[model samples]
Structure formats: C-alpha cells, structure tokens
Target chain A: MDKKKPKKVFVQGAIPPEKIANSVANHQSKTNIGAHSIFLGQVRADEVDGKTVTAIDYTAYEEMAENVFHEIREAAFAKFDITCAHIYHSLGKVNVGELCLFVFTSSAHRRIAIEATNFFVEEIKAKVPVFGKEIFEDETHQWKVNK
Target chain B: MKVTVKYFGLVAEAADKSEEVIELSEVLTASELKKQCLEGLAITDKDSVQIAVNQNLDDAITIKDGDEVALLPPFAGG
Candidate 1:
C-alpha cells in the first residue's frame, strides 16, 4: 500500500492517445506487470435502419457521471489485484469514425488483465451516464443511450 | 423553481433540443417532466425514457431552481 491515495477520474472530454500512453507508462513503472490489456472504442460510419451514421454528438450530465465513474473504479480496484486502470471518453460532436473511449488495465498476469478489461467495459456501459446522438448521413438523427 | 429539461438521443428527437427551462414548483419531479414532455409533444413510449438531473440518471429526482434535466431514450451506442 502506498501513502498516496489512488486517483479515480471521469472526464467528459476528448482523450489524446499520447496522454493515455504516458499514463500507462507510469503504471507499468510502478508495478512488475506482465500484461496490459487495452480496449479502444471507435465510432464507425454506418447506418441505423438505412440511415447512415455521419456523426455522433455526445453529451453528459458531467458532475453526476464523474461521481458514478469514480465509484465504479474504486469497486473494480477492490475486486481485482490490478496495478491501475483508466477510462477516457469524449464529448461534443464527434464525427463518424472517431475514437470516443479507451479502457486500459494492467495487472501482474495476462489472465487478470483480460478479465478485468471485460469487466471494466461492462460496468461502464451499464453504469456510466455518458450519452450520444447518432447522426445519419442524410441528416436524420436519433439518441444513443443504454437499453 | 424554474428548471431546464434537456433531451438527448431519442429523447432529444421527441423534445427536439438539448435542454429547456420550465417554470416548476418543488413538487415537480423528473417523472412529471416526462409526463409534461408527452403532453407538450407527441412523444411515445414514456416508460422507455431515461431522465438525468444535473447529468446523472435521475428517475424520480426532484427539481430545483436553475437545475438542468436531460431526457434520453434507449441507448444504442457501444
């Protein structure tokens, strides 16, 4: 156990790959990790029932969402013997085929990281307050929220 | 209390905006907003709606002055 408290963040903004890469480097330096699994979610240019998805406008109830995200992260750490985890998601109007989310988890072994990554994505989808609007190429649009 | 109601995803289609302010008293809640939404607009499937107050999922949340509320429909993004 370290003297400093662990950091949990939920940011409703765009994420740069370099920042995440740097954070991962920091985590690896702290732990003798054998495996680091990363999951990236990218928006795709496609259609919803014949309407092509040209762009996605994302929005969030930022304060509440951050609170929920931080709590979930703490729960994950309590359940897994992981070195570190990070989740970054985007906000505002994201064009078709843009990266919106990244989940990186590192642990002492491959098995733990893999399982933890899966759990991370699942919990995020179910719990996080992020929302998106799927914009069709034709100009028609629809809201994108969890079922 | 006057609070703003925001619509997102499918819910936005129904309300047709990111958010709007309505004159409400303390008795007004998130659920009442859904009803008002249906009455003000021709929105269907009121039960399928998801409500957020100040950005978190608030099904039965109460309203306050200057609070912003968001209405969302079934999430379809990954």
Candidate 2:
C-alpha cells in the first residue's frame, strides 16, 4: 500500500476556536469511528516576578519540526488501534487564553482515542523544537521552557 | 569548509542574529561548533543548548561543508 500522506499541522497564528468545530464536522462522514478525543493547549496568563504574561511568540525550526510531527503521528498509529489522528499547532504570536495546539484522535473505542491523543501531546511537548517567547504586559519578554 | 549555523529562541536572542555562515579549515563535532558559537554570546545555560547538524540533533556527529547546523534552546512546545 502507498504511504499515508501527512497532514499540514502548523497554522500561521493562534488557532481559532471555530476550527475545532469544523474538524469535528469534517469527521462526521467517517462512520466507523465510534469515539473521538480532542486536546487543546491554551496559553496561560502566567505571572513572573510581578509581571503578567500577555502573549507568547512561538517559532520553530520548521523543517525539522514538521518531520518530528510526522514521526509522532506514525508512532501513535503504530502504538494504538486508532482510526485517525489530527494535530495542529500555532506559529507566531498567541495571546493568553488562546489556543496554540490541538490534538484530535478517533478510534473504534474511547480508550484508544484518548490514549493516542495523550501520546501526541506528550511527544510534541518533549520532542518538537518549537520555542516560545513570553511577552509580559509591560512589553518585556522572557523565554519559556517546558518543565 | 563553510557551514550555515542557525539559532532559535533564547539562543537567537543572545546571538543577535538568526543565521550565519562560518568558514572552517577542519571538521568539528556539533558540540565543538556550538561552544564556538556561544563563546561571546550571553547564553548561560550551556547544558540546555543542543546542536543539530543537518537537522539531526546529535552532537557526536561530525559537521561537514555546507551543512545546516541549528543551536536550539530548551523546547517549550505544548
């Protein structure tokens, strides 16, 4: 069989809330999928040293990031009995309380969908080389590191 | 040999530029190249920095001419 084509995963800026709804609507035709799980990552308004974070400017080594994302997708499919999975991440600036990353998975059962979604989230966070610059309300900025 | 070096996140901020080219007479491991790049920069967390030679994040590999090297800081993706 031919290889499954990798979907484009990066959006220009903050991911719109309506995109989630659209994704679900698009999947309605796949009748065999009995369960779906979705994970959305929102930028938090974190306070650091008396400054409140207002937004995060995200950037990445795009070529490498895309390759890593494809690998993560392949690994998820290999490890789970999922029917399909979709992942979207934001580039550029994303304000606090806005969505930045979305992971959606579908399967014949709920357990597989949920587990696959979780795997994608963890792998993306640990392995992808995307960077974030937290801009404070006062306009000062600091680099963000995932703990 | 000339190599293209790219920087991202805090490393880019410290270096004051995103990418550049450096000419070298002898081959160097990714670690050695990263050290040279950070010599005059303001980066303090050397351990957190990783070097990718031609998109492969392995410092033990030898860098060659025209290869793309990236200095990546700690990943902060969600």
Candidate 3:
C-alpha cells in the first residue's frame, strides 16, 4: 500500500453509516490484513444549563487541519506495523446521535490495529486545528473544549 | 511587511472575520502578532489559543512578509 499519499480526511456534515460498511467491504481484497479496528465518534446530547445540545457546528483551519491530519497519519504508520489506516471527520453541522468521526485501522494482528486506532484518535483530538460549537435546543451555542 | 492572518473556530467568531492581512511596521514574533490580533476580543481564555506560522505550530517564530499565520482555538476533534 502507498502509505505516504495523503488522504482526504474531512467530509461535509455527518458521515453516513453506509460509508463505513463500504470501507470494510473494500478491504476484503487485501488478504494480508487479519484485524480491523474501528472508532466512531457520535455527537452527544449533553444538557448545559437548561438546554440540551442538539448539534455541533464543526469548523477548522482547513489548510492547516489537512496538514496536521497527514502528519498524524505519517506518525502512526511509523510507530505501528499496520497495513492501512483511514480517517474521516465532519466539517459542518452534525446532529446529535449522528456520526462525526470515523477511524479505521487494519493490521496483521489485533493489538497493532487497536493501538493505531487509539493513537489516531488521541492525536487528532490534541493536534488538529478543528473546533466545535455546541448548539443548544434553544438555538444558543458554546465553544467546545477538549479535555 | 505584510502577512496574511487566518482565524478559525471561536477566534473567527470573536474577530467577526475569517481572514485578514495586516501590515506590520515592526518585527513581531508569532505570539506578539497573535496578541495584537486578538486584542479586545471577547475570547475568555486567550492563553488556550495557539499560533501557527506557515502551517507549523510555533509561537517563537518571527513573522515575515507573505507568511501565512493562523489563530487557532482549542481543538475538539476525535
């Protein structure tokens, strides 16, 4: 596999569930992979004050974010013996209970795939220039900070 | 010298603009420029903001002509 090529990481709005299934089906031809680890991030309906979060309006420094995502992919490939890795994140409004982020990693063993997936998730949360605005049911909003 | 400054997320909302080009009469490091751009903004935690010069996160780097600078708020990705 060409590991150095940077893949598009951002998708508009919410990522469809069918995309995940299609991704899994596409990898069936690669017989060298024995395990696949997936991580899906869903928008949560958390109550703040008296209102509940209805959605998140995600935004990013797109140019910088793409670079950071590429860097994260390179680092993960260097640190783990993984067959492949794929990441997708939402760029616009994603409603509650909808998928916002998807991380998929495949490897010859289960441990490496799991570890690579975790690495991608943590790095993305810490390093990427993506931001989220939590919109409440009453149309009010607040900036979301990663803990 | 002039440099293009970009803002994202809360910073953009606070600034009311996504991008702007500023003319610098004196040399300023990335952090200094960040502060200048963010002056009077309503962002509560200015310390949590970060500056990126030419797509690399570094506050110590001095701003140069035609450089791309970005003001980034806290990341909330997964």
Candidate 4:
C-alpha cells in the first residue's frame, strides 16, 4: 500500500493550494501507474452582455447531488480499467477564472485515463443535481448548470 | 390517490423545496395534473414546464390512481 486510498468521497469548497500537491502525490506514489490524467474546470471572466463574470455561486440539491456523484464514480470504475478516480467539485463561491472541478484518473495505460476522465465529467454535468449561479460584475445573476 | 411531486431548479425555489405530496380525487392526464399543481400554488397553469410520471418523462399518458407524478421546471442544469 504505497498509494493513498481515500475512504470518504471529497465534495468540498475549492481545493486549497497544498491539497493539489497532495493529490498528485497520492496518485503517483510507487503505484506503478503508467498514466495519470486530469481535467480542471475554471470559471470564465468573459463578458456577458458587457457584464463581466465576477464569481459563481454554487449550490446543490445536496442529497441527490451526493448520491448522483457517488453513483457516477462507481459507474466509471466499472466501465474503465483505472485503479483509482477522484472527483472534486466546488461548493459555495468561486472567484473568476478559479478552478471549480478537478477529476483525476490513474490507470496502467493512457487510453483508459483519457476515456474515464471524459466519461465522468460528462455524466456528472448532465446527471448530477449541482447548479451554479453566475454573478456578473454588474450584480445581475443567471442560474445555469456548471457544464 | 396521493402521490409525491418533485420540483427542480428555479421552479423548486418558486414552489419551495423539491418533494411534496398532493391528493387527487381520480386519475388525471399528465396535462391536467399540471393544472392541479398550479391551482394548489395559486399560479396560472403554464404548459412550458415539463412533466414526468413515476420518474419517467411525460408521454401524454394518462396517470392512474396511486401513480407518482413529478412536475419539473425548465432545465438549467449544465
């Protein structure tokens, strides 16, 4: 057991600076992983109708969101040959151009890592109960799925 | 029959929460069921919102007694 095995699913606020390095170490430790693939989603500061996006307010139908996320993880594991997969999504406020989600997959080969990362992200977007409210610099807001 | 109705997204905020039970005297078509829900909430019936029966999407199918119905708001999920 050279590699880390997380018991609890991590759905928390933005991943802190130190946590990112720890996550990398967790997957790469003497585990003979041939490939590690990651997907990072960042908030955009692009102007919508001349109003810049300042931040995003994240919320979820918590019970349903957790169940949906957990189910997606299980399905991905069954569908891919990866040894481990981790998904982190932000709750509460996230600033412009900050990372909101990080999905990591480790496999004995590159193909599985690439495929599993895509599958998990797509399913999580379409199926989960997570919702985001885009707050413009001008103070207006629009609710949208955090795809 | 009394069945559970679940709301979603913005509509859930308007109607408060996502799940609640409503009573009906008899079976109603999916469209008619929408009307009853709005009546309960004192809003005029709007066809724009989607409907689902027993977790399956609306099929213009008539719902029978003891059938579960869910009223879904416009989808804004990503």
Candidate 5:
C-alpha cells in the first residue's frame, strides 16, 4: 500500500455499514497483516433539558481538517508498527444511531493495531477542526464540544 | 491589504456569514485580526475561538494580503 499518500477521509453523509465490510474485504490480499482493529463512532440521542437530540449536522474547515488528518496519519505510522490505516469521517447531517467516524488499523500483532486505532481516534477529536451541531427534536440546536 | 476570513461552526453562525474579506490599513497579528473580526459578535465564549493563517493554527503569525484566515471553534470530531 502507498502509505505516504494522503487519503480522503471525509464522507458527505453518515458512513454506511457496507463500507466497513468492503474495507475488510479489500485487505484480504495483505497476508502479512495478522491483526486488525476497527473503531466506529455513532451519534447518540442525548437529552438536553426537555429536548432530545435527533441528529448532528457536521461542518468543518475542510482544507485544514484534511491537512491535519494527514499529519496525524504520518505520526501514527511513525509511532506504530502498523501495516496500514484508514480513517473516515462524516461531513453532513448524520442521524442518531448512525455512524459518523470509522477507523481501521492493521498490524502484524494485535497490540500495535489496537493502539494505532485508539491514537487515531484521540488525535482526530482533539486536532481536527470539525464541528458538530446537535439538533434536537424541536429543531433547536447547540454546538457540541469534545470533552 | 485584504485578508479573506473564513468562519466555521458557532463562529459562522454568530457572525451570520461564512466568509468575508476585510481591508487592513496596517498589518495585524492573527489574534488581533481575530478580535477585530469577532468584535460585537453574539458568541458568548470568544476566547474559545482560534485563528489559523493559511491553514496553520498560529495566533502569532502576521496577517498578509490575500492570506486565508480561518476562525475555528472547539472541535467535536471523533
């Protein structure tokens, strides 16, 4: 795999479940990978006051976010003995119980793959300039912040 | 000198526009420009906003003509 090339990480809407399966199938030829770790982020229906969140409308500084994602990928590759990694995030509205982020990492051992996946998740939340507007059932909204 | 300022998330909502170009008679630091652009805006926590010059997050950088500046709020990605 071309590990140095930057991959497009943003999808227009919620990440589909079939894409996860496809990702796994695409890696079947890489016999050297003994372990793979995957992480999926789903939107939750959190209640704020009397309103319940129905969906999240995501927006981002696209150019900056893409560059930051690339930097995080480079750092992950340098820090872990991972064979390959893939990351995907949602850009538009994603309904509750839908997937928003998907991270996959493969390595010769289990620990390396797991650690890389966790690292990617943390870095993405803290570094990427992506924003989320939590929309309630009544159409009221509030900005979400990473905690 | 004119700089293109792009707003995102809560900043954009508060500013009521996604992007605008401002003419500056003199050079200003990214932080200064951030304050000037955010002045009188309805955003409650203005300190939470960050500035990026040409896609790099640096408040100390001096703004130049045609530079692309971004006002980013707290990130909520996963």
Candidate 6:
C-alpha cells in the first residue's frame, strides 16, 4: 500500500542512538519483513589544516527539502519491492561522533532491502537542499560540500 | 512581477540575507536573474550555484510573476 503522505524525516539536533533501538523494537509485529537494512551517518571529527571540526550546524529550505524527500521516497518505493522504509536526518547543530542520518528499509529479502537503502542514501546526498556548516574548535566555520 | 528570492548556505552568507521579495520590472530567464543576483556577491564559482524557479530545478524556464526563486549552493546532506 502506497501511503500518499510524505513522512517527516527531520529531527532537531542529533539523532539519539536509542531511537534506532526503539525503531527496531517497534517493527517487531511486521513478521513479513524478513530483512531490515540500516544505514547511519555520523559526524566525523576531521582535522582540517590546524583546526578540528567540532560540530555541524545543519540548515535547509524546509518546505522544498520536504517536497524533495517525498519525491525520493516515492521513487524508491516504485523502484524497489520494499515492505516499508524510514528515513531520518538531523537539523540544527549535531556534535561530532553523533548520528546525523538514519535510513532503515525492510523487505522480504536481503537484496531488496539493502538496495533500497543505498538508493535512498545516494538520492538524498544529491537531491536534498540541506546545507551544513562545519564548525571548528576555534569557532570558525566552513560550508561543507558533498563529494 | 513580484517574486520571492531565497538564498541558502554560502549564497545566503554572501548575500548577507536569507530571503527577499523583489519586483522584476522586466522578464528574465532563471540564468539571467541568477547572473544579475551574483554580480556584486563574493561567490567565485558561478557554475556551482543552481537556480530553482518555483522550487523546480529548471533553469530553462522563463521566470514570471509571483514565482519563488531560490539560489541554492551545493547540497551537503547525507
């Protein structure tokens, strides 16, 4: 069943690790889902020049981003045979080593679930209008570009 | 024609403003307006910036009245 509504995917600050556990726990009743593939994006504490990155402040054109996310989800469902999927991305400031993105896809088989998850991740990186400002230890910042 | 122009990421930083409502006395293509907007800004890589008209990433379309235009820098989402 295709749900016409776009699911909310943005979370303020970091994505709690416990949320992943709770999500897994909530899907227990879906016995038909034989495989669940998960992907977590963590903020890296990268050493740049002499300054170290401390956190990433995320901002987005929310209205457009949500619409693009909806399109991505719809495309993923049309391209794969997945039972269900969930995507979460962090907004605001997320500290280093914290989770920024979580994508979970469940399907009857492992291949479909894994493929769908990959598709979602790739599309999000390329399509979504989310911006990141990498704040350094010295309070200086630089805009992050996805490569 | 009236249009709401939004700036995001580096473009916002360069413009020193997030959004603005501008009245376009003359019609312009998305690319032409983008060039006009970037004229005095400090952005070096014009090719990296993308212009979206009415939230649709189509530069070929001519912008008309009451359109929402966005100047989007490179996407950094995960």
lDDT scores in order: 0.71, 0.93, 0.94, 0.70, 0.96, 0.94
For residues B2-72, write the lDDT of model 6, one tens digit per residue: 99999999999999999999989888999999998888999878789999998998898899998999999
Question: Clashes in model 1: which pairs?
Answer: A61-B55, A143-B9, A143-B10, A145-B75, A146-B75
Chain A accuracy of model 6 expressed as TM-score: 0.98
TM-score for the A-chain in each candidate structure: 0.84, 0.97, 0.99, 0.88, 0.99, 0.98
The candidate 2 chain A region of ten consecutive residues with least summed lDDT is: A1-10
Q: What DockQ does predicted model 6 obtain?
A: 0.93
Model 1, stretches more than 4 Å misplaced? A1-20, A145-147, B1-4, B25-29, B52-69, B76-78
- Rank the candidate models, highest DockQ first: 5, 2, 6, 3, 1, 4
Give fnat of each prediction, in order.
0.41, 0.96, 0.92, 0.18, 1.00, 0.94
Per-residue lDDT of candidate 4, residues A65-122 (tens digit):
5666777877887798887888788877888767778888888999999999999888
DockQ: which candidate is best?
A: 5
Task: Report DockQ per prediction, comma-separated.
Answer: 0.40, 0.95, 0.90, 0.26, 0.96, 0.93
Q: Which scores higher on TM-score, 2 or 3? A: 3
Query: Which lDDT tens digits does candidate 5 get at residues A35-81?
Result: 99999999999999989999999999999999999999999999999
Candidate 4: chain B TM-score equals 0.74
Kindly list the per-residue Cα lDDT of model 1 for residues B1-78, writing each as its tens digit. Answer: 788776665566655676677787547777876677666665567787777777656667877788777776655433
Candidate number with the higher lDDT (2 or 5): 5
Point out the higher-scoring one by lDDT: 3 or 4. 3
Docking category of candidate 3: high
Candidate 5 - chain A - TM: 0.99
Candidate 1 lDDT at A96 equals 66
Q: Taking chain A of candidate 4, what TM-score results?
A: 0.88
Error of 4 at B31 (Å): 7.1
Candidate 3 per-residue lDDT, tens place, A71-100, comes to 999999999999999999999999999999
